[model samples]
Target: GASSSVFSASSLASSLLSPFSSAVGLASSGFVSAAFSFTGDSTSFFTSSATTSACSVLGPLQHADYFGLGKLLSVRELFEARVHLGHKEGLLNDLMRPYLFGSRLGYHVIDLDKTLQHLFCALNFIAHVAYRNGIILFVTRHQQTAHMVEETARESHEFAHTRWWRPGLFTNSTAQFGTVTRLPDTVILLSTLDSVFEEHLAVKECNKLLIPTVAIMDTNCDPRLITYPIPGNDDTPAAIQLYCHLFKTAILRGKERRKKDEEAAARQQQEAAGTASDASKQPTSA
Candidate 1:
């Protein structure tokens, strides 16, 4: 039976604010500002903030930027590649759920943590591949987990000295289905099965007809429901932390490519403008 506890914004807020909410709030807000200001010129504000607070205090961060040199790939392209690999390896069903239903849901509900960890690892792996291929990645989750991701990103930036994290959008019970319509071509990372299951189901159904999805599968979730199901734990803080780190690394790698592309484009535009100015200044003796 589905738990009777209703998912609420207040509950999420309380969960996020429980201990280091102040720091998370600062980092999340800072990340948003930085993502938008990710032109080629400005200093990475989020990285600066993380250095001052989270990373310096947490320890060394794993730098994901080392894997950013490759041809660009899209989320859909990565999905297709994974599907091809799974099919060639005869692991299609093992890697993907055709349809999520009754007994499958039961299996997921039984061992949530291990299931979530598996799911996390798989998603992380996909994100890693996507990053290496130069594809952009974004993760979206319910508010509590989004807060956790932001906190982890801050820690990673501070420790790793890399500017590659963004704040995940927040969703709640009342508006659980909100962001799906706005999903970019990037991957979406869902967290906290109990809170976002309904929305997750909604997304699964919707994507079944149209969009391709990659998801983390906890034991509590029906594997059949997710396109890419990783069986593992969903309840442990350690599991969540591990998954978020993988995601942060992937996104950071993508960001590095994006930065380089932007710089190249800017440089070309400047050269063209300079050429045009030079032509205009030359005397036309006809």
Candidate 2:
């Protein structure tokens, strides 16, 4: 209920990203546990059972949210980011009717419970892709948040396409850029709609190319067009920042996991090589 557009107030603005202030200032799993517990243990979406530690059920130690990305942001924090606030009820799209938490002062309030499930799934997908070194492209249209989006991509060592979407970027890559020019394995659309009446061309282009998409869409936007639609207030800078923070964290976690895996493989190979050399030296005497 705090985001009154921009959150210009000094106190609110200062605490806007207290939990996600930096890469090291990451949010703890405590908040996540508390939030999920409050919501009647709705964590089944993230894992088989994250909270239950009974002897019968060991629970999945390595689950999708193993990175704790799901725990990084609580449902209450979603309200703080103004993600629950949607466009006016008059602009509601019938396709998005299911995501409504009901209208508040004529504007739609998105169901944060649903948002949590979809957001976790989307983040998990992103992290999995990143772990394989998959190319990810951030797409946005509004100049207001373009710089932030681009910066987020750069920090995560990914690509960003904030300018006009050339018609043949995906369908006709050879003609649009070059024959060797590669397309991203995944696309994250910060905003799916180009304007009030039209959806972004990249949405269709990615769908045609069979490239997966993770999109942040408002209540006025259609979720069917997106491979994974995260319902929230896509137009707000605060919300955009929150989205960027969560995604960037996921990417970094994925990369970190990849590094660890590579190191482990290398160590195993070295140990095997050493073992073979020792055996060769001892076999001559035998």
Model 2, 172-247: lDDT tens digits are 9998775668889889999998854489999999889888899998999988868778999999999999999999
Residue-wise lDDT of candidate 1 within 1-286, one digit each (tens)?
3222232433322322221223223221211111111122111112234333543343211211123211231223222222111111222233224222213322422233223323333433344334344332334445445667556546434211112122222223225554443433334444313353443433443344433345555433455544444443344555555556655665565456546656877999999999999999999999
| Model 2 C-alpha lDDT versus the unseen true structure | 0.75
Candidate 2 TM-score over all chains jointly: 0.78
lDDT of 1: 0.37
Q: Least lDDT summed over 10 consecutive residues: which range in candidate 1?
A: 29-38
For each candidate, what is the lDDT? 0.37, 0.75
Off by over 4 Å in 2: 1-62, 283-286
Best candidate according to lDDT: 2
